[model samples]
Target chain A: MIQVENLTKHFGPVRAVDGIDFHVGEGEVVGFLGPNGAGKSTTIRMLTCFLPPTAGSARVAGYDIYRDSLQVRSQVGYLPETVPLYPEMRVREFLRFRAALKGVSPRKARNARVEEVMDLCGVREVARKLVGHISRGYRQRVGLAEALVAEPPILILDEPTSGLDPNQRRKVKDLVRRLGEKRTVLFSSHILAEVEQVCSRVIIIHQGRIVGEGTREELVHRLAGGRRLLVQADGPAAELQAFVGGLPGCSEPRITGSQGDFTRVEASLEGEEDPRVRIYTWARERGKLLKELALAEPTLEEIFARLTLSPAFQEGEAGEEESP
Target chain B: MKRVLVVALRELLAFFLSPMAYVIGFLFVFFRGWETLALAKSFADSGQDLNAFPMLYAMGLCGQMMAVLAPPLLTMRLFAEEKRTGSLELLMTAPVKDWEVVLGKWAASLVFFMVLWAPTVLLLLLLQAPWLLGAHLAAGPIFTVHLWVLLAGGLFLAVGLFCSSLTQNQLIASISALVIINLLLWGPFIVARAGWVPAEGIWRELFSQVYILDHIQSSFGLGLIDTAHVWFYLSTTALFLFLTVRSVESRRWV
Candidate 1:
């Protein structure tokens, strides 16, 4: 539902969103993961038509962003990073206002749509309360409801669960996941775990460019060299490191740290192997106690770090180089 | 047109809920009342006839009151509050056109100012009490004169809305509106004293009596319906509203 090509937005001397390109298919929930000042919000703003791009082009639902901004805006629902709202307005009143602003016709239908979205976001009980009187979590929910009041096909939410508690965050995440079942969802967030939990695919961005984009498993397999392990031993740190280093398929072991009587070791295996059992048996025979041994699968956070830190991850090809 | 009405309705509702509208309305009534009562006392003390001139003078005072006071309070939050609260993004990104938003906001403030003038209609009615109750008292042309004042008040509100759209700081918006309104109201007096424009026929006509206050005082104060004067107020309103639309649209690009 969204196609961005060579999209670059420059703010005077600083390129806030440098020539990045990506697309989210219909009914796909794609998480935009980036650190602060990584151009996530800028990209979303350009897509939402709040800020015009300095160069390049984008298309939303087949409407050119530059040529058909009104159509693009009408087709998408945007929840800004700050969750702007009128504090004096009640939840229902605010949603009604948003519905009217979004061009919803027939007053009764507008109110019904507002009610539906409010109920969908689980904010129907407090619909009568002024937004200013509500808690942050509820206010975020209200913001979401306002965005959905128009019933736009695509949703662009920036930091949707930024300030919510764990339960509220889970509720919003689940709601987004459910919504993504039938609509396109593009959300930007700095929280890696939140993205991993709800996003079917992830796009990692840094310094105004997308560094990597793929499914969680695909990214882990691509970035990580298969089997890796972390071993903790109740023995001398040097002895544990030397023994693990000498094992087959195990690279040089690095002493992670010492906790109580146990020493932590991180080592990369050469190939897919059940090296944990062999390490355990060797430690038991040598009279060196093994406290814990677990295979370390690559995580989104690690992939993100590797992509951003690698010298090969150039800015120009960061976003457009991959798809899936 | 629907978007305009929706925005207008929301703004009007906000005006009734807020205290600023009430304060402006109360000040308008109090000042006009004081001026009328003072004129009545002066006529009584001098043993002169109470005529349309006294009511005209009071109407002029009303025009000055709105010119100085109404604009700042009414237009201070036109675009400033939205920018401050970050709702400008939502409005700008919506499908509604820029001109629609500008016109809607301008019309809303103008409507609020007009509602504030509603109480003045009662004041006009009260001013006609003597003529209605007593046979010896003469009716004055205050009603017609006050209509001109209302027109001038609408112009001020429109100009104020434009000024408010220029800035995101409420204090700055209010102060800018006050300065622009003052310049338009007193500009002729300053130019006449300084002799900046030629005191000849066409030049004098073009520059001297073209000030808002001069036209308003002449047309409304004398109960005269001049098409030029009406067009002047309307054109000024349209120009400001157009500028407001451009300013709002430029924000999307910036």
Candidate 2:
């Protein structure tokens, strides 16, 4: 559970995180999506109490980040953009140190916690190996394991899957999904597809401002009006364009390309009717062959780009003007 | 206290595990032992009494050496290593209080320094046993000198740890610590010779006699514990430890 109110962080002339507010309820998996220099990491650091907010306040796990930072930190597990690790320490030793640092009581429980997190993060195999000697993927897992050592109720991970391979990325995503089932998990990433796959809700930020925040479908619908159809035919390009363009309620069809026997046409349609049916009927009567006809919906990536680039989504207008 | 012990134990274990601690210990013992023996031999040849002053002087030098060398090795990794490797965030975000982390790191370096002194105890015991076995050995005075040396060494270690906390570069930390300790050790003589301060004044008293070496020499060389000297070492240690804590706390704001 986290509540951020008008949070802003300014570094001299640059506002890294402008006045923006958002909340993630308990057990919710929220993904923070932004391109490079979108102030996502700065936001994460502020929420974690690692950096003092130049203005505004954030309460993490019901504790004020500024007034009760220690409590907030105790309850929230943070994995910074670059997970800092002591290379000389063994995996178990490092985890043990973190356990002690977090003030986890009872000697037996500490040991159990170390073992539990080691297994939970799939780091049991390299428990005895030196942290420095491990691979990047394993090191990231160790970082996550350290965060989970105390079993904090909330997790704030900055680019958790940044440097992992495909398999490792999948593993991390699965781990986050599983963890999010019981705890509040807020992870930041620039990879749209990764966030789409694991995050239930997404918040898109750009230039120190929140540009868009919603479910995938809501965001797509809000940014992209509706779906359109892409059609390619085996006929003269001009004839196909004129035929599709003459259809009522259809915008002028743009001839995409004509290579040998195929001519591709892109048109903006008005309603939800299957444009393929109309195209097929027209092609049959016109003695033309239809090569491909498919409906194309806007993706999360396109929505993200549009929202971030929109003039209304500037930093000063972040929380003042809500977009859908 | 338990957190402090945890950190101290890890630091001590790391010191022993690495070659740096052994190398420093061997060098300390070898050089200090050679200097003490050589001085004793010269005194014996000259038919002078076996005074403890030369031994105190040698120990003071050893204290300065430990002060200059041990800290960078022990402390360079205190905050700098964490910042470099990103473990500092883990420590800072943990439930532990800022003071706990600071004290833990300080205690760790102190324990390591104490272990470095453990071998020197053998030298003291050897020097005491030979004279104690014979009549009129005056073991109390010799032991008193040894305690003074240990106190001075502890003060140096504390100052070194404080300096180490100021920077992340090992070399920079070590060099700055060396310069500071050297200034503190040689400051009295420089001030006394400069004659800039008026004689029989507070300025002269503060600058000429404020250094640790003079205070330590008066107590250990004379085989007496001056409350002022004890207080001086304790207060200096407290001041540096406090500074270390502040330096560490300020890092979070950055």
Candidate 2 per-residue lDDT, tens place, B1-254, comes to: 67776666666666666777788888888877766556555554665565554445445566556656666666666666666666667777777666777777777777777777677667656645543223233555666666665666566666767777787666777677777767766777676578765777787566534656666456656667777677777787788778878887785564
Error of 1 at B190 (Å): 1.7
Q: Residue B149, candidate 2: how far off, in angstroms?
A: 4.0
Error of 1 at B73 (Å): 1.4
Query: In model 2, which regions exceed 4 Å deviation?
Result: A233-252, A259-262, A268-290, A307-324, B53-60, B129-137, B196-209, B252-254
**Cα RMSD for predicted model 1:** 3.4
For model 1, state the Cα shift of residue B47 in Å: 6.2
After TM-score superposition, the amount by which residue B142's alpha carbon in candidate 1 deviates from its true location, in angstroms, is 3.7
The residue pairs in collision within model 1 are: none
On lDDT, the candidate that comes out on top is 1
Q: Kindly list the per-residue Cα lDDT of model 2 for residues A1-324, writing each as its tens digit.
A: 899888999998899998878899888999999998999999998888878888988898889988898899889888888888877788999888778777787878999999999999999999999888999999899989988888889999999999899999999999999998888899999998989988999988888878788889766555433556678988778878887777765675788887789999887665544567888888899888888888777778877777777776454336544542
TM-scores, in order shown? 0.90, 0.90
CA error at residue A180 for candidate 1, angstroms: 1.2
lDDT over C-alpha atoms for residue A296 of model 2: 74
